[model samples]
Target: MTTLYSLYFSLVHAFVGLWLTQIINRRPRLLGTWIAVFCTNVGLILSTAVYEQTGSKSAGVAAVAMVWVYNGAFFLSCSSIFFTAYANPVAMRSIGWKLYRFYTAILVVTGILIYFVIVETRGYTLQKIGELFDGKRVHLWVKSPVDDKESDGPDDGEIRA
Candidate 1:
């Protein structure tokens, strides 16, 4: 049963990863970033099933992975609260504008930061990626030179791993 569950988990992640890659390849960077942030929250749901039935070091590793993923889950709950406050009639009386407006401002600011901070890493090989980050801070607006080239990579909808 555990093996079956693991297989299911792997398959789900495979589909999600493929979908994410397609989005990243075809859409705006801000949209891809939002999708990634949303996906991170899904880890909290999967964490409960990570523990192995057998008592082993692998189980401990799974527990650690759960904790790591759990750290990102707070963003999901906070977003939900803000959305609820924005949508509810009674909640709109006092704090709705402040809460939801603040949330929107934060989202916009973070989206800008993510766009500037994250390097679009679609076609670069692992070695090329490492070299880019190896010795210096990458500056904003530095587009990858490989953008025009066709990527024979998984982002083209072919799963590599």
Candidate 2:
């Protein structure tokens, strides 16, 4: 059963790569390439490692959970770095590879620390979990509903006389 689940995830991961490649071909960008490479390569490496290290059914379940967590973190990290690098091409050009390596190291270290430090949030509310991260910042850019009013018609909830 675990093997079947693993096989399914592996196939999905492969398809995601193919889809990303097609998208990248249409709109090439350094950040996209970096995300594709890291997500595919590191995901394969770490998931395989987890599978190899775990043999029992409980261990296999834990391995599957680890794979899911790792993938989620991998996607988010890639996204954050992509936006940062995309916004600063000059800095990306000068220190992109260095930043990539540094971020990768930081991710690994942080994951290890989190594995040790994080408490299970199974029963916690979203707000409670968010508070663990210090809550939201007011200064962060968020598109207002007013901005969407321009595109949305009167019947679509736009206030109109």
The local lDDT score (0 to 100) that residue 156 gets in candidate 2 is: 31
TM-score of each: 0.33, 0.28
lDDT (CA) per prediction: 0.46, 0.47
lDDT measured at residue 95 in model 2 versus the true structure, 0 to 100: 60
> Over the stretch 87-112, how does candidate 2's per-residue lDDT look in tens digits?
54665467632444554665556555
Backbone clash count for every predicted candidate, in the order shown: 0, 0
Using lDDT, give the best candidate's number.
2
RMSD of each: 18.0, 16.0
**Model 1 per-residue lDDT tens digits across residues 25-53:** 52353455455544443442233234333
Score residue 29 of candidate 2 by CA lDDT: 32
Model 1 Cα shift for residue 159 (angstroms): 20
